[model samples]
Target: MALEAGTVVVDAAVTQAEPSSPQARTERFAWGPVLCLWVLLTGWSLLRVPIPGVNEPHYLGKARHWWNPDWCPGDFFLDSSNPHLVYYATFGSLTQWLAFDQAAFAGRAIGLLIVALGWQRLSQSLTGRRWDGVLALPVFLTLHATGNFSGEWLVGGTESKVPAYGFLFWAIGNLLIGRLLPAGALAGLAVSFHPLVGLWGVIAGAIATAGVLLQRRRRHDLQPTETTYSLVNIAAAVGLGVLLALPGLIPALQTLEGGDPQLEHAATQLQVAERLSHHLDPMRFPKTAYWFAGSLLAIWLLLLRDFPNDSRQRWWRWFVLSAVFIAVVGIAIGFGPRPMAQMPGFGWRSSLLKFYPFRLGDLILPVAVSLAAVQAVMSWTQQPSASVSKKSLLTAGLVACVIGAISIPFPDQNPSRLSPREQEDWIAACHWLRDHTERTAQVYATDVGWAIKWFAERPEYVNYKDVPQDAKSLVEWNQRLWKIARWRIAVMADGQVTPEELADLKQQTGLYALLVGRFGPVKAKPAYANENYRVYVLP
Candidate 1:
């Protein structure tokens, strides 16, 4: 006999039967533990000292500029370049609110919060349990701990890739809940912050949209209202995101109008695949591949086997596919001919630059960590029998937990942290520039511009190879300057200019002050000397 919705069917002889109550249908949200875990993870990521690579000093400097009321646009050390203004504005506002050191903790805090929230949301969507987010704790620690010594500008800071990752995860969470509009909006916001992150968003969004379509097809009786609402919401969210990003858009437009010469050269230079290969270290290949594969495997196990029938499974499949695409693209670049030339948009051959726009492979680690956690949860929920040995599984989980805990403390040395003495000298130089120099002075220094900007009381000029300048003229000017300078400060490991080259540089372009380290060879008498640095005023 069929049981009716409101009526309960019981055995005829049974004298008593318990009725199901409304309370049984209510869902419980576990907020307390999740919030605690978030707080703990955030604190751990923030308490560490800033590592040297990835332009930490540069970002700190930008934060200082944003925090200062006296500073205006165009005062940054680099020639007129516009960062995603919304992030800067938010950081600036938060610094004011907290009354903290804008360079040190205040700016990083915002990134930390965003990362934590995004991880929490992603975990919720993947595992349908809050505890599963614990797996992502290792990922958060790894990203926060890994310092960028590669001398690339985009690799570093709270404003760099970190926020983009946060936005990506947030979009994924919204997509999991059938919230396409909000997902699109999050993706739009991410693009405004970092245009490259749009690739991840597009991949994730496509998968989500496909999932919705598949679900509708599977359930033929489903109404169109849900689909229509989702589409409309996505459009609205994107529209609102655009409005939010207007400040960045306007400045970018103004910058493009002026036209940077270096940007043009960068576009041309990056076209060679050989240049791109130089940036990637062979040693990192194994680790990168491991993480990528692990994440994919975890996602597959969780969504395909455990949650095969779940509505959100299709989106998970799409996420895995997107990750795979990123990995495959990276491999192709690693092996293919005119490899750099194949990259889209920038130029026919411009993808060889160290910081190629769409090298989505960098995201493999985080995605893997996220999926691992989700898989663990799925496994936990699907345990075959109560008698099955939980001891071994628990031990494995504990081991993973221990490994993650230890990994956070072990700093990788590839980027090489500066010695304490070097750090002091660097800080001293920044302070001197900060106290000295006028606000409007276009102070040019090689190699130290990013750090100098971070420590400067005002903006000063530091030339970056990638800022987009006129290719023909700027390249010639840079070559001439390289001959005179005798020392290269722009890209680390590119090798110092030879003495003969310096003489040629002096003959070509009037060489001015040279900021050399304590150990840097000094041929001529320096105008000023300190324990850590010597300022050689060109004759």
Candidate 2:
């Protein structure tokens, strides 16, 4: 019999004879042990990586700027469109009290905690065992670290997508149990943080749900006992999701609209060809990535030799298949016979490619591998026991070794994409700029990377690493980068520029100062000099 609207559909693995209430659901899983394991593992993961990770400054700087516009006033990329407004409003508000580095550490800890808890809940729900999540945690972390076909990762750094993935995991867990409304609400929250991460999850989940319904229908004569959500429930979930996601959805949609065709095309091509080719272009993937992905798949298949017959197996199978199908479609589109522009339906495919279709599979497949391995091991070992077996001791030893190796706190931890000496010199130069220069000062630096605005609190003239998202701004940002490149090649040599060149750059770009790596053959004496860098005051 089909349940009425607003009913919480229980999983087939869960006994249907039990009274279904919110309190019963809350008490379904033991939280104490899961939380303890989550904290230890997640804390270790966060501390393993240093702060200001590759994209940390990229995101946290913008976040700081969002709350306090005066932080990096007039910076081009900082002033660009705000697609992750919800993230800025929530996590970015940390700038009010904490320093940028401190905020990054705090944010990473919280986000990873959410991710860890979500993964545990999902694992436990899918396996119908309390300790499966703990068993799978180390494997999941290791696989996620090494097994990505695209440049996608779950842990590391503070960004909008961290929390988005957390909520996405929760949504997927709820979906496994047919709790559509809660799943939809969680998915919507994920979208509010980062649209693409959550939207791809929703698509994969919808496909899985469809497969479940079709299979159930085909086997109607057998009268399957598993619970499935009705169409009305799906509609309500989608409706609630849309309603909750408007804050982020509206702004993201706006970026794609109201752009000149030529400018938009230029922006799309730049993103696909130059800026994000490593992510969007499948042909460019490294050979090692393929090996890693293939190895994980082989291991999963080997472990799951005979798939367990359980009520939840169908959902797990369908979800994995959906994720793989999405990845294959992405590969097919990206691996065009010719250039994307030369292909049929060029605009449609290029635009779709930008959303990164391979990401879902890159992330999801690792989770599946972890869960499947845990299920297999648990089944072979029988029920949970207080006595630790020899195999259990071995597994624990392996987990400890892996965690210790990755979490080695090296002395020379330079997190700002700079070498130890360069980071120190860069910070000193930025300190000079922050103290000596005005807030309106626009400094130009080619090799400083992304943290000048973060450390110096001054606007940047142009930075190649920081690209604006809006169509017009993207084109302009590109032009500025090329102009800087041309000037550097023509005039600057051996990390040196003459006074005449400095004056010309000042006149051309209205830059207040020039910061360059320390080198000889400079015609003009610098206003400030460090062991690794020099700051030249412009005319």
Candidate 3:
């Protein structure tokens, strides 16, 4: 008579005659549609962007370095403290056999496929309809692409988080169907891939579990429609989850320890205020972010208005509300007792904000809206009292077509975030450096972003985009940036660099070569010249 939490209580005789149980529906699940969805998702994510998309270099570059430390030997960021050892250990080996670009393409393909399959199953579990995934996929993509409070993206790019999210989705699907052990295992694997992402999923699952227990308690006095899970079941779920999460969780926690409080405080300030302001500081978000928040509110309102509450779906409600609660807490902290907008000093405020509270909401809110919208439509269509009209159907069809057309993935014109001519020149310069320069040579390229070490296969003095996570390294990285800033200011003052200035720059920074913009005048003759950039040898 007693059932574990999340287990559906089915009447055997009636369900055997109708074959309408959740298990029966799952047994009839078809893979053909899931495969088709996977292909669509692949095209949209992998084929839509060029190899080495935004974070590919950031993550893949580190992956390569982890496998072969000799690679970019003196690069500070690559050699800095690593908190994602599990990700490196899992994916870094690909660099041994394939080129960086090839490995990136392969990783993207694999990650996208996993995400598609997981999403399809998650959709089916929520609605108990196979085709609901097909209908909701485009909606999820639209809402996700529109805008978000934090700069978090689930799809696109080859990174640890992509596969982590895929596993998280699968865990949610399992949790919905009362498979706690499997859910815990999958969620644990998610944590191993990306601790922050996996932890969010774990937290959401915990919230759902609590909701299940409370709902069961509420119904205890009434006719026992469902029985509460034994304490053993709860402990088992938590124990399995912790066992699986330790690999990633331990490293992530270690990163927070053994840091100078003053230095860590400064690092947090730099992260929240300067380096990652767009992601960490809510006040730095653009108008589009606020608009997206309003759209999410509207979606929530519509779901409430259209759908009546169902006890079976209580877990889903609590799961989504957890994300909303996190975002609300983030907004409150962002504009709180002292207000981060005023550039509050280093303290608990900056420390808490640095962990990125809005990230989970960015992904979860859109997912909730997408599923709720489709479910509402299905409910309306099934209503016996509601009469459907041809004109209304036609209007709905038109709207769906418009949404589908907009969701079509197109190749980016500037995939590298550079113009074609500029990109060509940049690659040429990198290739030249790879062949002509020494492997251990230190090169400083102005505004090269994340690709210099990836392409040139050499160490860099410092990169603005690739900051180290540890406090001591971060402080050192900031010093290098200040050093670069001072040199650039002095050299660019006279619209030219004098011999004395070049000598001082070399002595101050110990540079073997300097790559500067083509328009910037230099006192010495360039070693190599391209239309967009010039590589200079430091005296």
User: Could you tell me every candidate's TM-score relative to the true structure?
Assistant: 0.69, 0.89, 0.88
In candidate 2, stretches whose alpha carbon ends up further than 4 angstroms from where it belongs are: 1-29, 219-236, 337-346, 383-388, 404-417, 493-496, 518-521
RMSD of each: 9.4, 4.0, 4.3
The TM-score ranking, best first, is: 2, 3, 1
Error of model 3, residue 174, in angstroms:
0.2
Please, what's the RMSD in Å of model 1?
9.4
In candidate 1, stretches whose alpha carbon ends up further than 4 angstroms from where it belongs are: 1-34, 47-53, 63-77, 93-101, 139-156, 211-235, 245-266, 270-304, 326-335, 338-361, 381-416, 436-450, 456-512, 518-520, 523-531
How well is each residue in 112-226 modelled by candidate 3, as lDDT tens digits?
7778777876777767778777766767776655566687877677888888888888777766655666766777788888888887766655566566556656775423343
Candidate 3 residues lying further than 4 Å off, grouped into runs, are: 1-24, 27-29, 215-234, 336-346, 380-415
Question: What are the per-residue Cα lDDT tens digits for candidate 1 across 267-341?
Answer: 355323333333342222455545644554555455445443344444455555555555455455444334334
Overall local distance difference test of candidate 3: 0.72
Judged by whole-model lDDT over C-alpha atoms, candidate 2 comes out at: 0.73
Better lDDT candidate (2, 3): 2
Between the candidate structures 1 and 2, which one is better when assessed by lDDT? 2
lDDT digits (tens) for residues 1-539 of candidate 2: 11111123233322232344221243265677468655756565556566667777778888888888887688888888888888888888887889888888888877877776677667766766666777776777676554479888777777888889888887766665667677677788888888888888777766765676577678754244655555676678777777777777777877777657888888988887678888988877888987887787677668767765444566667767787788889888877645556767667777878988988888888888888877776666664653468568648754774675465453213456577787888889989998999998998876665478778878887777777777888888898888778877778555666788878878888889888874334688888888888888987
